[model samples]
Target: MFQDPGVGVFQAWDYVVFAALFVISSGIGVFFAIKERTKNTSKEFLVGGKQMTCVPVALSLTASFMSAVTVLGTPSDVYRFGGSFIIFSIAYTMMVTLTAELFLPIFYRSGITSTYEYLELRFSKAVRMAATLIYIVQTILYTGVVVYAPALALNQVTGFNLWGSIFATGIVCTFYCTLGGLKAVVWSDVFQMVVMLMGFFTVLIQGTIKNGGPVAVWKAAQEGSRLNVFDFDPDPLRRHTFWTISIGGTFTWLGIYGVNQSTIQRCISCKSEKQAKLALYLNLLGLLVILVCAVFSGLVMYTFYAKCDPWTAGFVSAPDQIMAYFVMDILGHMPGLPGLFVACAFSGTLSTVAASINALATVTYEDFIKYWFKNLSERAGTWISKGLCIVFGVACTTMAVAASYMGGIVQAALSIHGMCGGPMLGLFSLGILFPWTNWKGAAGGLLAGITLSFWAGIGGFVYPAPASKMMPLHLNTSGCELRNSSDILTTLAPTMAPERPALADSWYSMSYLYYSAVGWLATVIAGLVITFLTGPTRGGDIKPVLIRPVCNLLCFWSEEYRKACWCGVEHDAADMDLSGDYISTDILAMRREEPTEISKKDGKDSGDDLPGHIAEDRSYTNAGFTKDTDL
Candidate 1:
């Protein structure tokens, strides 16, 4: 009963449903903008006045990174690479737990806006600015892919102009994000999350019914060799092995959930640290829910195309388009259902793009612009934040147009993360975990890590693995009704092979999944070497609050030994003063110490012992600055 779609497939009701997504998203932004019009300071604009509850923040956290890449690419990946891609679920669990235990505590205690500000506190201004630039580049490139992926799919199925879709999605996202700030972004994310899930479920339920049932789908996958989940081969060159995905994938996602500013901004916006932790754990559950839906959707696609394989039949030009084609072919008769799927992809686009744009604006204002204009007004800063959102939104939308020429949506996005993330993750890890690493080490390590990642990632792109090495699991076009005998043979024929290169010469042949791991290791190793050569930072020079102890695993050691192992910095009882959840005891003690004690301890005037920046910025008593001077 299925027929190929030669033109646009969306019905009148389908357009209505699709249009409603933007309307609702824009409305949420307007509501928040109006509500907070009286007091839309920089703090309120950036972090919702730090009074947000856990639920919206949690949903926003999950929705921030769960863009069209996951919705469209995950299914396409599983269908082509087998169910081994599901191993990423393990990676997901690892990243969330590690982030919760190790990273969140320090972030909540600091109460900072820009995540990169911690870089300055731990290292120096140069390192902080370097990290900020890297984040900006990584986010812009990734947002491009996020916007482009859904637009490409829409173009394929509905004959929508690709650029029009990109601008429409981008403009709507920019409108809401610029109008309402973080509150609008978070609430819109919550609303969009619902729409996205509904769309995914519509495709899954309808597609499963058309394919018979779960058992039949599984059987089809098994026959097609698409159920290869437990591939334990230890070869690094093999594409989708369990170790590569689980281990390398852990570092890849850790770069996102652990230290990336997009999720960090949402997490720290909550009213308290406890609320922030709750949001992270809840985000884990949301991630697993979306993961299951995406993986199952891939399986359903495999069931329908088990014998025909849409790509080889020339029904679709790319693997990414297969999901869109399946939606139109299967759900086309149902009118608004196909529109729901489109809405799903667009919801993902809006949430992710909006989050990235907001976070970018935050870092630009807090890290770069604020220092330049010390006398900038609160009202001016708020307007600047909105203006920055518009600027980033337009820039990202333009990049989306450029991202169209790239290959395989999932791989491209993850590779970008791995290449940039590994270095950024390495920089943060060096600063937080090892107190001995000085500014030289931090700067050198970041540079080296990025160099290696790009060399490998770019090399891999230029000289891709040979067809024999990178070939997909057996896909057949034997059942395609439109294909004649000759056509089928041509579709299935093997092309002439290029001469095989030597293993030593083919470093780029390493699985793309391991790019993050490679970059991370390069950074750590290079960093330690540079630190030792440049004379490691003394324990006295580092702050205890900035260092996270890695000695939790030393249960067999004595308490004193564990304490000594942690940054080797001595902490007196008076070092930490906790007011509410934000800890700044040591900082306050320095400022409030008796004049005689200050003279005795540092041989300097009272308050002169504090760092110049800290003393100059009087509002920096709590974490970095007080409410009166946060901007």
Candidate 2:
């Protein structure tokens, strides 16, 4: 049996405030959906009719990035590992700039609703299917964990049953997502982002004030060595070092910014390429603010409980429960603060789940169902999209329940996503960078990448060091100590043990930064080597024209090598057919060879391209084309 932390009993005002907040926030979603029902074109539903501005995109991007993991897990990370995790913000900053300078131009110019559509254009149908499937699986699992973490936290804090919380949250999110589509999700995310930041900063400031001041907090952190940031020892087995955090962290960040649908979908929906880039930059600013607040809150927690150590005092067992413990007990006496914090924490979970459900629905409707049905009616498609939201929502809710047994939602989610994401990123990279990679190479590389990552993850768990003396340099750190000890104790302690070894869990507990490198290397090496051995693919099968210049920059091939390999037929710089607007080869040839620059004076290309009519008719009759197969 569970007991409600008596905070619920004394704080009727807080509960009332929270309930009102929930009603208002959720009511906004329902209202938006009801009002926007008539505006349910596929484009509008999936990508906001590609007219979303920078501010909303920036806000929604922040909300999506800081999920339940950041709300609950970042504090836990700080509590367990200290401020070393802050290095991740540096990686995130680099990723934002990289995305803006590299990937955004290609995706925006392509003008596809789904970013994965670019995979098909550059690579083969098989590669696109594989990459999209990986994303779908990874996101469902990721959403399941996100939905689960907060419900569990809220269950601990508010005494609601875990299943009940999961069901309630999932149902509400699914409802709005199914009905309102991307617009509702994005706008609601803007609201949720504000609440989340307010909640975190409120607790942070109040916690710091109660702990005497920033001086006291810093002194407490320094006493506990919580402020130490740089750990530069070169050990692969260690967790939270500069090397692991930077290199591994960069790839992990790249996976989210570069490959994930939930984030990139926002970028693709911008009103212009410039707006998309601006949103990316603004997201970086928001991330920096949130990271400071979250890290500072953790330091404040150290100050508040430095002497008492409430965790050891039997107040809470798990690190994740630290924030709740602070809110309910430390800040319990304050009025309205507790409710606001709870709302803020819950906002992270809700916004992420809602965004994910929307992305999942779009992928299902566009990629899977449409592929089979060929031409489903708009009404039927809408129903199917709604139905998928319900089905996946329930499935994710169940998985969230299962996540409880996994231990540490943040680490679990990151590890699982890393395993799958590496290959997906690799596939996209190969498609964009290497035009010669055939379906066989791409598919083979994907399989190999996943296999190697799984093997490495398992090996890190089972075998920390080699049996023979000639093994590679085994520089173990405190993070890998547990796993190393566990393996040695299990083997030697049973037969001729003199004393028990102090063991950490398997290196499987290694910080998640390593997973991306392991996956990326495995895929790229296998894919490139196998493809090279197989020789260049057929020219018809290779879409060299679709490979972006930015991708080529990442490739090792020199500029001269690229030019020599292209065999003299230059890919037309101005040829873009992604809008399903095809120009015949004859027409293209007949057009002036020299570039005709369009003047900005007329405001022609600068304005939004969305049609004005509510029900605009699209004809498939340019040059006798019968079916809309371009998509």
Candidate 3:
């Protein structure tokens, strides 16, 4: 083992940068909660009153997926493997297009509070509850991973105990998410995004200057085969292939951004369905730009440490610590640089955790508690929501404390996401894409999809696979001879990975990147098969949910079908029924008659009976939790 000199310690001002973030975030939370207390309803607390513009939602979306996992894992992955992973941008592109085209209209038009509420309208309450349960499980696990990623990294370089960092992150995020709800979360996320971008420039500019420039970094990465971005091989065992990443990433994001409560809430919160679509589309560009810079930073790290492999030389405990190591190496001399970078990492952590806490609370209140305790007062519901945020915050912190027991946070996070995301995405797709898919079909497909997903995920991730082991790209450690190797090695014994199993050469070695796509296909295929086998529902039964084209595809067969479809939406008067008003089920489980029709038929101007804005103007008030919507 070899070692490099450490970057001594943080100055007093460094602490100031971190402290300011806490104060501002806490104050924002308190300010919003109290300010909105008068006008605040369950709707306001959850979705920011649905008056949001595109930029904030877009930025929040960017912040969600820009977790510490990306900040640390991208650099480590590039260092260990190649930059081919950057092809995931293609996935982001697909997510934007597909979401804008198929998902946004249905979800936005429905005007429901929770994403799972769409399940009840399309299928059954059972499906809604089931999907909600899956989402809860996925997000809770995801929050733990998100919280743990930065805490672990900060611990390695700054000597801040992981436990302390985890607890601190949870407390601050919970406090604000509990107070201001969505507004506070969104504004805090905006602040964090600025800090993240600042950290990006600091590392890139400073690291590039120290490494002799961009050209030098490129040359170093090229020599080590770290710049390979196009691997066309179809082998599932060979991870990071182009098809697997792009296709797999597409489904993974669709599972997350397309159907998850966190991202959907942002879309729902937009001023209009069109605005949500625009914001979601714009989110793609932001993610691409950030990731491109993040990937390059990895190559730059290789440039500076080309002659000193940190993992092999033993300056760090794991490969994930490389980013913090490089930050200290290049920017350590600048008094606040280290703190800024740590802040950047925590920005990802705190924004994501806060977003998750808020979304979890929102869903719990809207989906589960709201239905059972129908008569509960608004104040009591809000308090319960705040309490839920605190509970989830603590749960995430606890998971962080135990996160060390899990393996690589990067792959672990992706796999956990895929394992749950796939099935959930499938359930939503069934409701959106195929109208004939009944509750039975959705339930069966979801169960089977989840089972297959877990089996493949566990076999691929948890179990051993020897032949599939990724050999580290050759390292140039000649420049690392100045320090005594034994001393550093003694403090942290370099992890010698365990031996692989014979199954590594079999189907069990399938890469986790493609798990998202796998889960989605299993669900759709299984859903379609089951729907046909068990007597299918009438085509009329589905017009309320199916995409227009799919519904239109059935028009040639029957006149009744054409008349029955086009379930909602305000179309031209030419298509209006003889009765003189639109009949819509958009307010699922809430209203049976359109307000205009109800008022006219009842012979009274009684529209106030329902919360009218609940239809389109309500959505998630907080930031993009993991996928980055600000509060």
TM-scores, in order shown? 0.91, 0.82, 0.88
lDDT of 3 by residue, 494-607 (tens): 566666566645656777877777788889889988988997666555434234335645673665555555443334434333432222343221232234542333564343
User: Per-residue alpha-carbon lDDT of model 2 for 519-600, expressed as tens digits?
Assistant: 8877877888888888755544433324553333443256565444443324443543564222333224323322222212
* Cα lDDT of model 1 by residue, 94-167, tens digit: 99998887787676555578888788878888989998999999999999999999998888777889999999
Q: List the residue pairs that clash in candidate 1.
A: 577-585, 619-626, 620-624
Model 2, residue pairs in steric clash: 482-503, 482-504, 483-504, 483-505
Candidate 3 lDDT for residue 617: 27
Error of 2 at 107 (Å): 2.3
CA deviation > 4 Å runs, candidate 3: 1-3, 467-471, 482-504, 543-631
Best-first order by TM-score: 1, 3, 2
| Steric overlap count per candidate | 3, 4, 32
Looking at candidate 1, the ten consecutive residues that score lowest on lDDT are: 611-620
Taken over the whole model, the C-alpha lDDT of each candidate is 0.82, 0.68, 0.76
Which prediction has the highest lDDT against the true structure? 1
The local distance difference test score of model 1 is: 0.82
